[model samples]
Target: MTIRIFRPLRVRDFRLLWSGMTISALGDGIYTVALAWQVYDLSNTPTALSVVGVAWFLPQVASVLLAGVIADRVDRRLLMIFADVLRAIAIGVLGVLSVAGELRLWHVWVLVALYGIGNSFFYPAYTALVPQVVSKELLVEAAALRQFVRPLTMRVAGPALGGAIVAGLGAGAAFLIDAASFGASIAALLLMTARPVIRAEGKTMGSVLGDMRDGVRYVLSQRWLSMTLLAVTFAMIFFLGPVFVLMPFVVKNHLQGGAGGLGLVFAAGGVGALVSSLVMAQRGLPRRPLVVVYVAWALAAFALVGYAEADDLWEAVLVSALSVGALVAGQIVWEALLQRCVPSEYLGRVASVDSFVSSGLVPLSLAITGPIAGALGALVTLRWAGVIAGAILLGFLVVLSAATALQPRPDPGRA
Candidate 1:
């Protein structure tokens, strides 16, 4: 079982891509802690804290569709490398200013905007690039391997390492470490000898806008794809942003903890996710992926209800593990299904459109979360958000069940 899960690593291109992604994802975890602390340090308000996320998510909303078009027209390897370079330079400059004590709240927003643009461009290219390097037989394992390494590095090791660095050295050092990690990914991209095959033969358009519209129509035409996107979009709109904006406060004010404590909580979630990913990797995804995705997500949303009520840091840690573990399990299934089902010609555009729709409201959600937290208090708001999100997810399951029940059944006598 272990051998099967690790089989993707034997492919040279996938191994390189995976290795680079692992390093980069770890850096991302480190950056998450560093960025949160840096923003909070500058202005200790929920509203102020939201600016960084708003900056990050706004570009994702604005340019993701265009990024998809660009990914299809260009070399995906070069596109990813460009994104890494842009993000690295942005963070590198921020790290320099931060360490020198000249950094301010506004600088964080501005620089992270550039980082966000780079981020918005990277994913579509990365998603489309994967299948070009790996065989159909190994694609599922490749996805599983990625899920495994992501939690192992990003969630578990990254946050723990970031928290220690921030505690011992400071957030500036953590920022620099994150900036440096991009170099490993860039090097891997540079070393790849093969030019990936692009499948956009008849899919090209006279204009980028035409391309974007085509992508949207394609997604809309597929009921399974569109339905899955709709479910994730609404659920994330209610859950993701509030959690990101509020969790720090819950750790700080409610639990009386610091960056290290928050990191520990994040790491706990990673540990649980690691276990969940391992099980999926070993056994492979369940036969019914759509069912698994919604069920797992519903359980995750409900787990947050317990999170808001945690009495101490340890209790929070345990709940974090469960909620985040369930989230990872669903994500692994959904992503693997996406790669397997989508035509390669549409993969880049579809990936972008998928991200755009799923995340479209996230910025607004982040923008509102602060004001909501300020009015209702972070824990109260989080608790209510969990209930709403959980109920909505279960509603999706109910609808699916009813539809299945209404389907016509076959009989041997009729045949």
Candidate 2:
């Protein structure tokens, strides 16, 4: 299990991608801390912080279908390389502004929106690109290994390292670090021996809205994929969205803590995720991935509901740690299932649908969270979100159980 962390490095292509992703993820960690702190410092309001989240996520929802179409119609490696370069430029702009003493809230919003656009492109391509690199038999192992590395970078090393940089150097330095990582990622991508070839060419001047509709229709046509998307989409909106948006408020209001306190909690969550990743990397996933996924979400629901009732910082942190573990483990399973169940030809389009639905509702959640928190109070809203999410998830579990039980098995002789 310990050695599983290094197992993916054995494959040449996967190793390159992993290394690049790790470097970029490190920058992501630093940027995340700096961004959050910067937003809070500038506005001193939770709504302001929430707006920054909206800026970041709005682009994701907007660009998802376009990103998907491009991923399918162009060389994936080129798409990734372009995305890395564009994002690098955006981060560099932020770094330059900060260094020049001209940084502003609007500047942050613009840059983050640009970065979000790149992210929409990067995610679908990256997800689709994985199955092309690894053999089918090793997909679960590869996905688990990838999931394991993310927390190691962003959650654990990212925030802590970013905090240290901010404390010692400045937020400008952190932004510069993010830029450099993007450069490194682009270089690694350029070095790939065999880049994927995309061959869908009808017309370049077609309507983006129509393309989006086509993507959505394609996803809904499949039972398993539709169900998966529905689950993840709602999950993102209710569970993940609030958790991220409210973390700062939780630290400031409830824990009476500072940036360091938030960093510590995130680091703890990282540790929990890393531990779970290690287990999955070594043993691989359970045979019935659907069951494993549902169970993981069930655990997350419990963790959040428990967190809503925490009496102290330590109790909150404990629940957060558990929730983080479940979240990452479930993601690992979901990624593998996408690779296994969705056809390669439709991977990009399907991934776009996955991104659109799962991420589209997030900005809406962020937008509404502020108002809801302000009206109902942050603590009350937090508690309500947890309870509602848990109840919904339990209902999903029951329905899934019934569906699986009623599904007829194929005859052995037919095989």
Model 1, span 1-415: residue lDDT tens: 2567788789898889989988999999899888888888888888887667788778767888888888877778999999999999989988898899999988988899999899889999888887778765566677777877887776667888999999998899999999999999999999886565455547434588887787788788666677667777787877876678788778888898789899888788878877777777776756777788888898898776776899999998998888888988888777776676676657788899888876787777777888888998887888888888888877877776666621212111110
- Candidate 1, clashing residue pairs? none
Best by lDDT: 1
Which number leads on TM-score? 2
Off by over 4 Å in 2: 36-51, 197-211, 245-263, 367-384, 404-415
The sequence of per-residue lDDT tens digits that candidate 2 reaches over residues 188-294 is 88787665543345534346567567667767766556766676666666676568777668766778767877766777787778777877767675677776776
Q: How badly does each model clash, as a count of residue pairs?
A: 0, 0
Total clashes for model 2: 0
lDDT of 2 at 301: 63
- Model 2 alpha-carbon miss at residue 222, Å: 1.5
Worst 10 residues of 2 by lDDT: 406-415
Q: How far is candidate 1 from the true structure (C-alpha RMSD, Å)?
A: 5.3
